[model samples]
Target chain A: MSFKVRQEIATCGGKLLKLSHFSELIGLSMDVNVYLPKQYYSKDYEKVIPTVYYLSGLTCSPDNASEKAFWQFQADKYGFGMVFPDTSPRGDSVPDDPEKSWDFGIAASFYVNATKKPYDKHYMMYDYIHKELPVLLDEHFSESSTKKLDFLDNVGITGHSMGGYGALTGFLKNYDANRYKSCSAFAPIVNPSSVPWGQKAFKGYLSDDENDWDKYDPCKLIKRITNTRNDMILIHQGTKDPFLKDNLKTDLLTEASKNTSWEGKIDIRYADGYDHSYFFVSTFVPDHARFHAKNLGLI
Target chain B: MSFKVRQEIATCGGKLLKLSHFSELIGLSMDVNVYLPKQYYSKDYEKVIPTVYYLSGLTCSPDNASEKAFWQFQADKYGFGMVFPDTSPRGDSVPDDPEKSWDFGIAASFYVNATKKPYDKHYMMYDYIHKELPVLLDEHFSESSTKKLDFLDNVGITGHSMGGYGALTGFLKNYDANRYKSCSAFAPIVNPSSVPWGQKAFKGYLSDDENDWDKYDPCKLIKRITNTRNDMILIHQGTKDPFLKDNLKTDLLTEASKNTSWEGKIDIRYADGYDHSYFFVSTFVPDHARFHAKNLGLI
Candidate 1:
């Protein structure tokens, strides 16, 4: 990862640092924000905390997750590291869909392997989160010191919307059994096959083959979890979420888990009067932090 | 305020409600996210809690603070209201400075009464916080209910950078002594007279007469306070802030409070290797919340 340390400022608590990293991995130079807990530099150098990688939904960058999620308090108190990466690659010349839509082109990069002609080159978010980012995060920040390559000292993953799907499947698929112990999501698109966002992005990013689409779907992937991580997966969904009925199939996941080993392991909470936005996610983020903290044994 | 209630989602043991409130005051349709505590609709409607209004710095809107500050957990546990307002009035015709500087145009409203010609119409943020917005908040949100307001229910104002200045002065000047109680800031522009941001904003928003600047200046306002409201004021500043020298005058406010009734009442915490941003604010927001909770007798 050939990246430039754009700006590093000492925040009121920890360090608010930004880095511009570019690679052939993703077409654009991603801006990443790392919030190293106060304990990062404290006398407890040997003390390593579990890291949480937050992927923003669409049209967001590292700055969005860093600014919007309000996770630092939990990170600092819970003693965890947070890594935020841009949702999709960006630049003027990059090829985009002929039609303009919020879901495709700029803001939306389905966390899948884009097999389509135009987007296939740079839409490699799966690798960015799974392989490349871990290396990049370890190299630049203090969390790099905790790079034991073991899931216990190293990591956990979570995100909202598309990013949450990434977090759900990314941690499920990527981490060595030793490195990833827990995963959670906030209002994630569960059955992407049924959701408009997922269907559109999937069709554009992948071939017509439904098998390829299954690989990226969390609902489909949850069915394939051979062994559970920890005991349960925590998911908070809003009952009033505009897209919940059409897009986020919390019920489908609930039913699927009920019939599988994942039964009693999927904790699906139906939050009332909420929507598909960060405000819903931000409200419950600390709970996610606490959830991870408890299960990860960080607390 | 003709606001379209878009979506209200409840989660994180609370409620996340989004609304599109059009401020004839700002001539812009603003997106605001309000977090209602779990007990908001409980049987105990009379239960009062302290509310903290977080003002975003330049180039930020209400959306930024709600997205980033990461305050909900504490707000949920401690039971306080958080009100986030957009930085400046925005609209197509709203005059922006010819120079698209981050500090001057969209993000930076200076929070003072803008005396400049174009900004004069919509830049009435001073009134928005003190008068119009409060009425709207009380009308829509439970915390703003009359019983809660009667207790002089603890009202603490806090913010980062320019918003910090707004929090400081807003509390000092227009604060309903009978209602709002505590005041704190994170890396505020204490004495705008000394900082470039202060000089530019003061000149644009106020009269050329330097004496008038004292009205909005926190250091100057400190000397104006004859009786301390709650016990003291809390300020957390980053020593390594990039704009520490140019934008913030911590020493001036520190010295000013030292000579007044606030002498021992001012709690100034200087954190090492931090800067003027939300990362810094989030690191210490819990302490500030605890400070208000204690002063409000919520512990």
Candidate 2:
């Protein structure tokens, strides 16, 4: 459960600690970046810092969101920490896509527990992220600092694109337990089981069966899970995003929520002229931060 | 004098226009990115917008600073435009370092007009940046928009690393004429003539002669140029920056300014434990933005 500190960088009234630790669930070493906001360093700060887990999109590392998301400024303002987990497990031993494609291999885990051969050995990200990482983080941070951090229960979850889908699925799957207090996404693939990128990943990592794919899909999870707390899911999708029409059909999420307990609880804001890059993500990060801050009871 | 817009990305309450145009002095196509603030699009706004030119460091295109500087947010906040100019001319015909070292060739023009053989053909960045590019930008932006932009006259200058040296040299040399209304730097190489990076660039671009090198060195320029307006140059240097010991000795500028009119006017703030990366630059960008905003009469 102990993490090795790689680089602790001073940035934006806080420190970004780049850490590497062995994952007992995935059976691989993983890198994660945790930003401890300015309040964390304050001696008088008595409250346990609640974290927002930010998952990155395909073909990304922890560094992408840590560098470009521009979340530190907002985190400092709201007194919240941020966790940026790697998109997938990576190493020479780790099996990659046979086609050498970016979407289904090393940096494209899709946050799924693989049921297929070769991939089943290392692609247990779904279990690692939700079940194990948070508990391990809660323990490590508590032992490391006098001021505690609530990574397990009092946390929020958000991501971009594929990670966005992961966030929605995770938040909905654990909705009954209230694992995450807040949920949001930036250009997420809401209904992953129907999309080409998701289909390919599912076939490669799981199986060809739609029944197996439906288990991890956000659209299916929305109908299965009952929202008892009258919670909201915040999302921002850019109109000019190239992947909007094909892979990320944001409207399908609203359609899936209709006649269900989650109907009208999805706040999806379509930003005009914005694309699916970090530029778009950073622009609306302030808004998302406010949403998460409110749910986490910071504001 | 005309610019071709390669890409216009909507980022934070503004549009980042990646433009390309032929430089008359350098005799090559140069890339520059201009960020137009949200105020520019306002229909009823009457005031002419002022620009702040941000020169990038070595081994970087116009896109590096445009993507990472986080200047768009500040530009939108202050209602001022930002111009990110390339460091050097590029192409197959352009002469690079014989050894292909990243510091003294291709992207390392030192923002100086080369006086040597093949480099002289294309490495005329000094004249292009401080003299030609601004006028061309003024002409192009004025013709394109209903609300004019003051790119040439009422503009500020700033940069990082090698470009930091560029900012200091340009601001001091043009102080008498007040070419740049404001100036600032992040981890700048102050005494370029004394440093190894500056020595190699000066020898390669200018000549072996110390007198030629002195003309472009900020240490020398401060003594030569009189600070008649009692203007101050704000500079931020990271204490943990790797180059601080050698290439970027921030105190040398202060040492050179003593007994001169520039004494006590070079406000260099040494920030603790910040590195020479965009992380450090972006952290201090808010401070620099406020400084430029006030100087440009935007605040």
Candidate 3:
């Protein structure tokens, strides 16, 4: 088995499998936590469980969402599994932020394939997350069994903050191919190319060229990609989020969606008196879970 | 207000208020997190909100349970507030274990009033949790207002591991006074007098004498206290808990209850494949919440 079991913890009605495997894409041993719902162990159950990939925000690892997001209950309730992937590749060999800041390097990959020197060697989060990870998970999990889990085909994607931006970018970039059956975000950095957090990451990972950024910018991707399936993207932004006014201008995505096929389908919700913490992510997780469940044909 | 608001975070249709205040009993400042449910903000609702006091395990602050317990949803659903108290009195002034072990010093108070040496002056968690904290909370929250919350009465007590022992000790010691309307625990140290973790704390905080330890031990308290109201104490023990074979030994509590008035009233449910972490506590929080809600008349 390529994936090593770090720990198998029983939570809610299922087990949380903390797995780590060497990713050829990111060139590091990537950690991921998968919550297999109660149905997986039920003798009477027959359906192959679909999965929801939850990407965490800055300074986060796979354990953060696994511990705090409270998604295991929702996954069990809907009879779906949850996959929590690490924010970025890490090790002593990997290059870090030159200034040692949180927003540019290490735990802040921006889920982009880096093109710059130093970072380009190991910071291949985009390809790791969207390409290698899912297929590998399916092969490792299903190849040995009766296809109890489907990680490649019937999948949904969602994230928080930087991860939200990742979800949007990956979803929009692969909209035509329908890589993600459902997509949503919580307090995501929508217009990363315009924001400082995104600009720093884009400039550090990619070059100063705007062309490199336009390839992954959700705002630009939203305008170019046509919604062939009439699928809607769910979003929840807290009014009291510390980053709302500055980094996460969620309204910018709404504006970018204007006059495009994705316009009016990007459902943006404003949660009053909430912050950009796990408290907010966990609170709205039910809504996002249900939305994904319906889209992934779980409901 | 004598209590300072450290932070007020919105979580799951409620606000988690992090408060810190000087504790005259313990002679140190203590931190606590209180979650005021959604019912508190409703103009249409008039019932005074009862509270559940959740004592955390060793080496945990109020923030651990406040963030990981996933109780705010249950509190909002059951129309009850939640109180997350610090495990022990902190700051450099407070005495720590001579060995600086996590099970006996700093974060680990064993929720008992110490009677020996430097520990006696500060390790007054028993009085701090059951007596002073509750009365002080009521005085601070309801002294001037229309009494929206009841901290002194109509309360439930619950905890995990070391804190579970705290809950049981607090509940049984005050059983005659009818202090808490409900009590429950998640993988609690049932017989602290015998367990190594509990014995270490007892020796450090109390004394070498077994008599002093008997006062705080649940096994002794269960036999001494009579359940006049026939109140049941709910407990969830994990079969796969690493501490089960040694420190916890939850079945001992059941054995101790054999001939006493509390016999069969201590309902212990063993969860399969669970562990000694917050993952286990959070998984069964719903069950404990329901049990407390029913006993506290929230159902």
**TM-scores of all models?**
0.84, 0.99, 0.99
Residues B1-299, candidate 2: write the lDDT tens digits: 39999988988988999999999899989999999998898887778899998989999899888878899999888889999999999999899999999998899999999999889999999999999999899889778877888998889999999999999899988999889999999999999888899888998888888899999999999999755786789999889999999899999999999999889999999899899989899999999999999998887
TM-score of chain B of 3: 0.98
Instruction: Estimate every model's Cα lDDT from 0 to 1.
Output: 0.74, 0.92, 0.91
CAPRI grade, predicted model 1: medium
Candidate 2 CAPRI category: high
Q: After superposition, how far is residue B237 of candidate 3 from its true place, in Å?
A: 0.7
lDDT of 1 by residue, B1-299 (tens): 34566755555566555677876676667666666666565666566755677778988877666656667766777787677777887778777777878887577887877777877877888777766776776665544344453222456778888998898898877543644577788888889987898888877777888778998898888787765554677898888788888779687887877767767767889987777767677778889889877766678
Q: How far out, in Å, is residue A134 in model 1? A: 3.1
Supply DockQ values for each candidate. 0.52, 0.82, 0.93
Top candidate, metric DockQ:
3
lDDT of 2 by residue, A1-299 (tens): 49999999999999999999999888889999999999999998888899999999999999999988899999999999999999999999999999989899898999999999999998999998998899899899888878988999889999999999999988988898888999999999988888899999998999888888888999998888865788999999999999999999999999999999889999999999999999899999999999999999999
Error at B37, model 2, angstroms: 0.7
